[model samples]
Target chain A: MTADRGRNRRTAALLISGGVLLALFLVSLTLGRYPVPLWDVVRILWHRFWALFGLSTPVVWTDAMEIAVISVRLPRVVMACLVGCSLSAAGATFQGVFRNPMASPDILGASSGAAFGAALAILLGCSARFVTIFAFLGAILTVALVFLISARAPGLRVVNLILAGIMVGSLFSAGTSYLKLVADPANQLPAITYWLLGSLSGTRLASILPAAIPMALGLVPLLLLRWRLNLLSLGDSEARALGVNTDLLRAVLILCATLVTAASISVSGVIGWVGLVIPHLSRKLVGSDNRALLPCSMLTGAAFLLLVDDVSRNLLATEIPIGILTAVIGAPFFIYLLLRKEKTL
Target chain B: MKKTIALLLAAMMLIALVGCTKTPNAPDAAGTRSFTDSVGRTVEVPNEITKVAISGPLAQIVVFALCPDRLVGIAQKWDKTAERFLATEYYQLPELGQLYGGKGEMNLETLLSSGAQVVIDVGEPKGSIREDLDALSEQTGIPFVHITATIGTMGEAYQKLGELLNMPEEAEALATYCDAQYARITEIAERVDKANLLYITGDKGLNVIARDSYHAEIIDLLGNNLAVVDSPSSKGTGNEVDMESLLLWDPDVILFAPDSVYASVGSDPLWSELKAIRNGTYYEVPMGPYNWMGFPPSVQRILGMLWMAKLLYPDAADYDLYAEAAAYFRLFYHCELSEADYDALVRNSVGKQ
Candidate 1:
């Protein structure tokens, strides 16, 4: 009876979180630098939704309004959802796999690699699209390098992998710093700085699908394998004793998480706190159980980032970098949640 | 505990009160004369002024134009493109870094060893100008003074710069020349109807110099700059907006930064949706040594205004662009403008890049 109640409560929590995410998504789509009325935001989304199904309604809204909501705002809203969901889910997966409370999505040098790649691209005066491509390549390469080094090391596999990650990540960070030093101060330096401090201000409908497809690829497997993440957390010896290939499972999970992280960061740049903080916040709300935690983290992160991006685009005429807002806003909220948890204790 | 606390509080108040009354301005020494600067800070400057240091690139440009020989060091190293336009001695000065924003701070060791008598800061006054200059002056033991140099008032800046540098006749000639050019630009600006224009920058051509920004002084003066955002970015990259916003803005004339998507914007299908792109009204800003439009906002923009004027309204400009370019190159850059160099500089600017 107690187990059934626990399951029911978890289901209830998921439904509520999903509802909140949906509501935030709509809110985010409405809010932007361009003033589109609330009603028009609905009308544009509604008209575009039916148009996708070949039901062309009578056009009442202006092209600018349609373009603002559908072309400009929709992609940004979607990018936020993709980045937030990927980071949170990946972060949770890393924590569970490593059995480390401090592990984040960039635990394997993905973010630093992305940063170095982005800085180099900016230094080369590459277009925004190429910058994203270079960043994605950088992330994948660094993580692969980490795996290669860790594979041959003579320590505990997870420990060696983490140490290798630290070394590689630091080297990439140093590379990013060097690029910044050498970049043209007039234009390239600011572009690189803005890229380092993540933003969704550059998101376009055309760029969205490329990033989203890879993010979906990584996220779908993460959801399917979340039940097994719990087994890995119970120690590799115990999981192996129970007849699971712990090494293979760990490798697949890490790759999936890395892919999602790289794709999200390449598009949105390096948004920090969502990956590191959201899963912990989700764990507080749900539990440490990966089955409940992963979905919860994804939903909460999507909502959190969507909310932050809304404020980022709408709060000022200039874009306050999304990464900055995440920490500035998230730290206080996290502290509040922790305090509430402490009070309950 | 209350007695000890009261004693500590009393001591702290005493320190604060003493600090408030302590005048940072030192009384005039024998060799220095008091000069009232733009921000109304009376600074004791050397009477026989020779070596001058600049605070940043903006100051470097104006100072170089006025007294190129006196500058102790360049704030930023001139690019290789400047080699043909500027003498090696001027462009190859030891870089003193900068006092304010950019990659590096002012190298004190370099400045001290270079034997600069006074450091002069010119450009728009940031909020903490007086305090910052005074603090630098105190720290370096070299008098620091600020002279306000705006896009509209650099002519007057030349006169003030002349006073500080003790070169009134040369300052007068340059000042009069600047005043004439600015007045002509303003007259030409008033003669034409403002076109809906967008100045786009960044490698992607997604950023816009918003209306009322310092960078958009010429754009706003000449045309209706449409990229009005809530908080305009002060950085040279401007505000980063997507292509959709560009389409929504739908400017009649689009000016691309020299470093931006001028070379490839024509090929993109998404960009081709914009009326400016479709109409082929987009053009790159001219650059040789520096962007004619204000990035660091130096005296070179005197030519930028004329180019923009002629580009926007040919009839009202009422002056030969090549004639103006040749004269500006001779006076400011100290390089002769061959017809070919002028053509090359403005080749893409006149039409599509």
Candidate 2:
């Protein structure tokens, strides 16, 4: 009866998440700078349904629709999904390893480090793709430093790790500030600022691929070890007693989380809220079982991001930064979390 | 605990008082301080303009044009070639950090350490900037002047700059020359029906100027019919029209720059679609120290307009293009163009790219 109850909850999560993604996909396809009719979108989707199975369609309207979907909306939606899932997965990994709910992808100074790297690349007048590579390197370097500095005892102390991250984050932030200082007032500085504000506007398929591969690799391992994450959540000693090598597990988890977080940040800029809120929502839905929570968080994060990105494109004549839109929606939810914390305390 | 609080409060009050104190003008040998500048304005200048700063390229350009000796700082580089060219001047002149979108967030300590005397800004006047400049003036006794661009109101703007710089005669000469050029361009432009002119560049992708822009106004002054007069977004200032919009608004006589339109469409793909391209009416605009054919109606632009009018309507004018170009430079820029320089300006066309 208990097993059946768990199965029912998982099925509900799957169905709800699947429905949200489908709705978001439709919204993304129809709503943009040039809005298309919902009926036309539906017609294209139905006609091109066979094309998905590698069969050619005679309808030319379907071809145009396909190009719009594949060329424009598809990459954007895929980017949103990849970024959202990666951030949430990394967030959950961080929260578990740190044994603190407040811990996020940025807690280890990944975002600031990436921002500094991006600024450096922009200042040098290199391609935007070079900025992504620099961001990844910065994130890894920051996390590595955080790990090295905080490795004082048998296991990593949560407070020490956070302090180290803050210090490193500030140092990297100073680097970003320095680049902004030296950058050309007319062109480079504004470009750097806009890039840092976190938008997915100027991404191409080639630029997206590097970030996607590492995130995919990191997420698979995270999903497979989701049950072990639940074990780790039951305090370090308890997790250790359950035949889990806590130190080794933590090392692997940190590496995966950093890689995935770095991958997402390098591609789409630093998008917040998904990492912090999605895991908490997943826990509320699936009763803190990492097995169910991880997949649920991934889906919810993807759907949430796609919806926000859809709003970003259509709501304003100019493409509004997805990061700004997410924060506007997420801040209220975060306030609720804080209020709930007050009641619990 | 009460004593400690009192001590902290006292320290805070002391700091606040220090901040509130008026910056003292240094006394002269006679012990009477007469705070005045070369402009003859009785304005106080601090003993030091330490933390000397500038905002945009225009700010640096104004300093270079007016008082190159007074400049203690500069901003970041854009083009690598431009950077190499400007490096000697840049190394000699310290940069006061990057100005964020002309929003000068000066590193106060770095600026102060440098012992800068004045901060010169050249761009659109911002509110917070005025406040900061006022505060810095009160705090450090450094004078800040916003030099206006001599684009729209050329003669008046140049005179105002002269009044600020204490160069009244040079200013009058500049203003007179600018006025003559403006009148000449308008008189010549009046004779032609507004021809469909597309000002595109080969360097950047699909970014074109509209009639509302400062650049467009110059083209309008030259008496040309703008292809895409309507812009996409009427946001902050200028509108960046997209590629699809360009296709919809077909132009007659295309005057494209080298760097802007050269990337995407080489050898003119729209040969059949465009009247200008098909008839070979498309002409590459001349680019030198200043891009002539690209409209934004500066003092240097008169030369470009003359060249463009001569190229597009050779029968319309019997004036010598070379002599006109040289005269315009001498009259406005206050520098004589050498024979080679005049040839370079004339030969430097959009077709060269």
Candidate 3:
């Protein structure tokens, strides 16, 4: 009876957060430095919906209003939700696979490698699109290197992976610093620093739409395999006795998580704290079961980032990089979570 | 006893004479004159300024233009493109680094050792500039002077620079040119129909110079700047903006910064939706040794003003573009600009013919 009650509560938490996320998305679409009437936002979206089905409607709203709603706010809000959800879900998956609460999506050097690649692109004076592409490739390459070293080494696979990740991550970080040292201090160095701090101010529909494909590819697998994540969270020997292929499952799960992480960071820049703090926050809301924790983290993260991004772009006319807002908000909320008296995860 | 007294007296006289002898590269106390800088700080500057150092790129360009031979070390090295219009010897001057920018601080050791008499800071004065320069001067034992030069004040800045450098005639010529050009731009700006203008920058062309920002001085003067935001960024990168903002601002005319999305925006489906791009009103800012607009916000901006005025109001600004550009190149860069040179410079900006 208790287990059933626990399940019901978890389901309710999921629905509540999911509903909150949808509400936040709608609200975020209406907010920007450029003011559009809420009615116009709704009208423009409705008109576009019908237009997609080969219907022409009279446009009551000005062209600027339509463009602001469809072109600017919609893509930015959507990208924020996508990035936030991916990072948090990836973080939860990493923690479960490693059975370490401290593990984050970038534990395997994804963020550092992406940062290094972006610095190199900036140094070379590559365009924004190339910089995004380079960062994504850099992340994938770093994770692949970690796996290669772990698989070849004559030691415990998990331990080897962790150690290898640290070593590779450091190497990429050093490379990024060197690029910064050589970058044109007037322009390129600041560009690299801004990218490191992260921002969604530059998101275009064209850029985010292509990136969504890879994010979806990674996110779907993690959702389908989340139940197995519970078994994997158990000790390796115990999981083996239960007939789960611990090695193969761990590899597949990690690859998907890295993919999600890489895609999230490549477009948005290196946003920290969300992957680390949001999963823990999710654990507090829902019980520690992977089934409840992963989805809850995803829904909560989407809402959390959307709210922060809205503040980032609107708090000042000049963009305060979204990464900065996350750290400032994420750090304080984490302190409150730590002080609370509760059953620990 | 008399010999001992005579010897002691001679030795004392010798020591006094040695102290009076001038130190190499040291300013004679008598040679320095009290000169009031832009911020009202009275500085003792050398009378016959033979060797000058720059605190940043702004000063480097202004000083190099006024008295190229007197420059001891350039604050920043000119890019390879500078070789086309600038003399090889001038462009290859010792790079002593900048004082206030993100890249490298002014190397005091280098400036002092190079035997430069004074280090000049140019352009608009920051809030603490007087104190900053004062502190730097006190720390390094090198005298520093700042000359305030906004788009409207270039003539005064040039005059102040001339007096400090002791080249009154050359300074007067440049100053007169500046004053005349300012009047012409004012005339053009007054007569021209206001076109809603947006200055787009960055690799992705997602950045904009907000209205009234330092980088947009020329744009604001020549056109109706439309990128007004709550807080304008002081940085050269301007503010990061999205395409939606551009569409909403709906500027009829657009200026793309060099090395931005100008080369690709023509083919991009999303960019083509913009009124400026679709109407062919967007043009890349002309760049060579330096951007023709106001990134440095220095002497080049005078040229940038003329070029911008011409682009905005061709009828009121009906003076020959090539003739004006040739005169500027000859005076500032000391390089003769042939018809081919003039054509090549504006090729990407104005497009062929």
Candidate 4:
């Protein structure tokens, strides 16, 4: 009877999560400058999925609507989903690894490092693509340096790691400040400022692929270790007694989280607030059991980001950067979460 | 593995050769150059500077005219916006961020990475910034050059920069053009009474130049009786004046920049009651390449003055105004004047009071 109940709960969770994602996807697709009817959107999605397989079936207006939906809106929505999922997953993993729920991706100096790379690239005439590449490289380098500097053994001490990240992040921030000071007032400064704010436009397939491949590689191992993550969350010594290789596990998770965070940042620039807030929300919804929490976090994050990005792009004739919009919405939500969590605790 | 080794060796040799070609030791204008800059400073600008970085928009324009490929960097802002306004073909050149403003504050690592031989700053040096500039120049082994921001300084700056880059003739012609325009404007203004002029933007005092400011110097050349508004120290904090002050200083003729409250007075309820609006003596400012009349301090503002003169005193001269407009655009902006770009420049040279 207990087994049956457990199966039923899992099934229900899966169904609800899938339903939320699908509903949010539909809403995102429909809410744009050129609003398509429900039937047209369904047809458009149908045509896009089929067309990819070299199938030649054309219902009237399917081609244009498909282009509008898939080419124009789909990449942005998909990117938001991917970035959101990765960031939240990384955040959850980091918080668990560190035994600190307050942890987020940028806390380890990754965003600051990426911002420095991007600022340098702009100063040197490199375009958005190179900016992403350099930023990812900087993030990877920063994480490596943080790990190296903070490691008491082969793995990191949580407090030491945080301290090293703060040190490195501040150094990079100083570099960025220097770049801003010397930049031309008439032209380059505004562009850098806008880029730093983080727009999701001008992201081509090429830019997306570099980030996506690394994320996929990182996420696979993570999904496999989801059960282990729950055990790991019960403090490091408890995790070790339960037959987990705690040091190896910590390193792997940190590397994976860094990969996911860096990949997302490369394509999307530095989007803040989502990673910090979504995992907490996931925890609230399904409790802090990593098994349910990880997947739920991903789902909630994907849906929330898509909803935010949709508002960002469609609310005005000129699209506000997703980073700014996310903060505007999420900061208040996060404060609310803290207030609610405080009452419960 | 052997082939890879050989290829790497070849690449290293090529890089060395490229490095050597960058430092051509050209002599300065005095012939027996003392290897010293102005302010009695000793600095080493490698003979032929292959890699250079510029700080200002006008400075970048000057450098581009001299050597298109030599610029290694600029302030980030130049790389984004103003470079787009340059003829489309020149957009593909390399840039470095504004490593320094008028004073040189560059990343030594970034400068070395780009292999810049000299640094060019395009404005007057601010306090303490000059010291930083000197320090950076010494540390980076890149000679720093400063260009002034005067009426005829663009030509001189360009020519000197061109000479440094082995493109003197182009720079000379540009300088001569600027000199002639300056001379002509001076000649024209000397004949008119410099007192009766009223400047406002739409219904507000967005900006005003008094007889003491640099803006006043340019307006003074227009040969008009300057009617000045008493701008308080608290108003617009030295950039603009209040609308109330503008109404109080109502004069015979009102000239306005684009989108100003002064221009809107003919239609504005508060301003329609003003004497200038009632007499139909309002004018809309001209728009030209780089916002000539809108921001009346660019070299293009000379064209604004000629247009203004034609409108205010139509009986004053028999100048071929369109020809002059066409010539100025052709010479400075390096484009054949479209009738629209020209008309837009002079159309509402000034608007309703």
Specify the highest-lDDT model's number: 1
Instruction: Tell how far residue B42 is off in model 4, in angstroms.
Output: 49
Range of the 10 consecutive residues with the lowest summed lDDT in candidate 1 chain A: A55-64
Looking at model 2 chain B, report the run of 10 residues with the lowest lDDT sum. Answer: B25-34
Give candidate 4 misplaced runs (Cα > 4 Å): A1-11, A62-66, A152-156, A341-345, B1-353
- What is candidate 3's CAPRI-style docking category based on DockQ? incorrect
RMSD of each: 23.0, 24.0, 25.5, 16.3
Model 4 TM: 0.54
DockQ of 3: 0.01
Model 1: per-residue Cα lDDT at residue B340 = 93
lDDT of 4: 0.64
TM-score of each: 0.54, 0.51, 0.54, 0.54
Q: In candidate 3, what are the lDDT values of residues A296-317, reduced to their tens digit? A: 9999999999899888766743
lDDT of each: 0.82, 0.64, 0.81, 0.64
Off by over 4 Å in 1: A339-345, B1-353
Q: Write model 4 residue lDDT over B187-224, tens digit each, in one string.
A: 65666554466565423455554544434545545635
Candidate 3 chain B — worst ten consecutive residues by lDDT sum?
A: B100-109
For TM-score, candidate 2 versus 4, the one ahead is 4
Docking class of 1: incorrect
